[model samples]
Target: MTSLQHVSTISAPLPAPSRQPFALALSILLTAGLTGYLFNAQDSHASLVLLLGAALGITLYHASFGFTTAWRTFITTGRGKAIRAQMLMLAVAVCLFFPALSAGELFGQPVNGFVRPLSVSVLFGAFIFGIGMQIGNGCASGNLYHAGGGQLRAIPSMIGFAAGALWATRDYEWWTTQPSLAPVGLIDMMGVVPAIILNLLVFAAIAGLTRHLEKRRHGELERDDNGSDQPWSRRLLSGPWPFIWGAVALAVLNFATLALIGRPWAVALGYPLWGAKAAEAMNLGLDVDFWGYWLMPGRDTALMGGILEDSASLMNIGVILGALMAATLAGRFSLSWKMPVLQWLAAIIGGLMLGYGATIAFGCNIGAYFGGIASGSLHGWLWLVAAFAGSFVGTWLRPLFGFSRT
Candidate 1:
């Protein structure tokens, strides 16, 4: 869902040769074993989903397509290049998804886009998520790929995500009382062409606005594209890819997801389900009917099922493994086992916020922001505005965590 920026162009400007054969071997073995398990445990579709997740991870890693970093850079430096990428990604996804969704099927399977209710929860959740991104230093998808690339900090954030997600889901028994608008689909409400035109107009306006701001602030979109002289083949296999490619890959894969799974891309839904499974293992007397969301749309089954049975979970695994493979091939795998207390605390706190905010908001950067907007849900637009505002405030708070400029 990135949005990337001048802050850290994807892949760290052609990563220096930093290979680990052991890591490479381990990654290969892990990928093979997982693929085998999925094929045997469920079916080819499950294995395919896992492979797609890995592809997402690889594309995200090599391209360094990041939502949190991109938005943070914009908030602090007024660089809108990454934000532009985010817009482009959304536009591409909508262009592909809307038509298929309107058609109601792809290859004989029913197709649908994410269209959650616009609610007070979205307002609160998105704003908190914005602030959380600053503290966490990564969005939901960002953490998965980064963790795979050996960023130890993301591990704690992930743990916190599970905690926050479970907590909020468990607490939603009361939160559901908040007001919400009935769900609406632009295609159904105003027809597909009009919806596309309206969304494109918004996208163009934003892009234009950002270009103006970037010029007024930094005189132009900042770039390091010319700084690197890496060979094309090397860049393709073991290095930094341009952000545009990341956007393209995400759009294509999301479309493939629709064709394969009958839905657009999503990542965070797996968090709570994982937590529920954990609670059940601990004999916490977890009930599927404790909160209504779990019972809606066959979610209870996904909650009770194994990881391989959940599309989002399988995709998440693929993303992590894909990032690992990409990092290994690019020779950029490094894990630090040490961290300052404040930073660690920030990571944990931020992660909890990410989980809570996203859960309550109905999705994270991926689900709510990307999938929501692509699905033509108005709440996604609201999520963007609130999250951006929160990010603005978060930039100021970053200094407290020893972050020079988050």
Candidate 2:
């Protein structure tokens, strides 16, 4: 008897659900809630408004940089001096901060944020964060914005980062109790004018270094006939207007986020919050002080208590939505889940490292490095050094982990 052969078709497992929608919704709701809280909250800092402006500026910068052909070339070609621009901006920010602090009008109010110098913790934290970013495929700021654009890898990286952060937060007290590397608030000594001049000098030095490097590399490319030897001027002007404007706009957005939120832009804390909540939900009995120490909660008065709720959580939500809106409008949005399992694992691990490292550093690249530099903190510079060193190490290991060189 010829039995009817029953054949079952096996299909590859369906890709993980896109969390973009959830991310978007959560962002909107959180933003709305925070806005309401700010409007209704009795105690407020005037510096917040200026911080908001900075946040806006940051957003503009990112968007513009991403879309701009010129900026892209500067980033990818190594010939265009994007790094120089960044250094210039950092110097400018440092100069501006001291003047602003002295004049009490930099952000339209007296500057209150304390500026601190480098520390051992900052160096160590930066190394860890830098390595984490390389493995996760983006830095803290890069991850939030990119994840919004539908990079599945970013999701895992973000998760890992948060987990790491949570772990770090639990140990924050001990970390802070350690000895600091330099005197806190070095900018306070030099005041505004000298600081600005110093920064400009540094900028000039970096420009000279960049020019030297470019000239050295020019002949090699010419001999190879790679057609990659574009002039700096041409590279700077290659992208359309939107790209340039978009980056500037993002920079403004970053400023705005800070002003309104009363904190610099960040992303790792959200993950830690989630982790903490999960731990609590599972009855793990984690210490509340751990979260509280990280400014997870605000101060409390006899009549009322302040809470440091998750601001980044909302900001991240908005970031994803904003990016999604941009991508969807431009037809650049696509669903992708093509990463290999090992890479996925790496992303998660890297993210966790980022989370922990960022917490120990008291911020991620955005909050600590970018904002820190802009705020005239010496630790910012240290972070860059450590992180870049870590990035180099990460790059060396990438091939071994199946990552493409490109």
Candidate 3:
């Protein structure tokens, strides 16, 4: 080939990733049906929340936005691009969230953030959750999307997650008794503007720190994939999106969630409910109501009512179905049954830790770290510090379970 032709050929867009038409069709059909059901059964708001979750799944899958992977990469290789993306995400989310929370509503709906106590339970739980993220190879949202994207490994992790969350419920009251401060929201303590400024400052500092560390280690910042020369429309439809795009999309969708549902986006809350429902089905001798957690007013109602009645459950379902749609559209939907015994053990144990830790911590990465921080809650910052510490240890342990640190 001539020089010009060679250059043109090299720059040309790569072939499209294969699309799983059947899977795509299935996801589309299910999404449509669910939207109708949620609208009729609950309200327009419920339907909208489900769609927002679908949007979140698509964003997550396309951008490969994952806390576990980002933290692990930073821990193992000092690559800070993904970590910086996380900061961008947080910054955007805080900006969107704080204004609404400060006003105490979004649109006509009264809204609330995920502000909770800073407690020993949170410290210990977030720490273990970080470790779980490394070993399980996925965090709360990660496992859901992975499962949705047809990763067989996530199945075992989810099963263990459910079981572990159930186990935590058995002793939920004990965790509540631990030493803790009352809920402290930056927005609540400081004015909204001040809280936003503080959060923005912290995000910038973290991002800058990562850049410095990455530069020191690699002698330059690592660049993200710039993407091929495909049209933006095609890339949007079947994407390996830029991380910055993912961050922005997530922030917007999360804001949508708040406006629609009067609360931020959260998924881990669904795990224990599914677990309890499953246990009930199997006639597991455990009396769910006997647990103090379930004995709470809303908890009892959720357990007794149909799963569709629960907003979190609906959103979680949407996430999975949405991810499936994204995966199939990207022609990346496939499964593997083969897992080494050691790796399998890691999945189960790690999942258990994730489930248990999230339950005690009152949320996972999405709920605790992302939602908490976006809400300007002190606990969110605590969760971040503790989880990162745990992730550091978990990264070191990955090789023992046959996972590469990178």
Top model by lDDT, which number?
A: 3
Tens digits of per-residue lDDT, candidate 1, 1-406, equal 3221232244235544455777877887899899998899789999899999999899888788878877777777888777787778878888988888999999898998888888889899999989888876778999898888887668888888888888889776566789989887898898889999999889889988988988999876766362257777787777577667777788889889889999878898888887777777888886745577687676878876787799989999999999888878877677754667887888898889888888899898888888888888898898999888878777678879877674
Residue by residue across 1-406, what tens digits does model 3's lDDT show?
0001111112335335554677788889999999998888789877887888888888887778888877877887898888899899999999899989999988899999998999999999999999998888888887777777777677888899999899999988999999999999898789889988988999999999999999999999987663556677877887767778888998889888888888888888888998999999999879888899999888889899878888888888888888888878877677655778998999999999999999999899999998999899999999999999999998889899988877
Give all candidates' CA lDDT scores: 0.81, 0.53, 0.84
Candidate 3 yields a Cα-based lDDT of: 0.84
Candidate 1 Cα deviation (angstroms), residue 272: 0.4
| TM-score against native, each model | 0.94, 0.72, 0.94
Question: Candidate 2's residue-wise lDDT over 1-406, tens digit each?
Answer: 0000000001222122242455545544544565556556633432233234234323422233321122223333445344554555455455445555455443553344435546667777878877676666666656555555455556777767767877887777777777786635545767767766776787689767766766677732212111124343322222112233443444445444444554445555466666665566678787644354545334112102222334555455556555444333223346566778878877887788788887777677666766676666677667767876776666555566677433
**Candidate 2 or 1, higher lDDT:** 1
Could you tell me which 10 consecutive residues in candidate 1 have the lowest summed lDDT?
Answer: 2-11
Off by over 4 Å in 2: 1-80, 104-110, 219-247, 261-263, 268-271, 290-309
Reference-based lDDT, residue 322, model 3: 84
By TM-score, rank the candidates, best first.
3, 1, 2
Question: Candidate 2's C-alpha lDDT?
Answer: 0.53
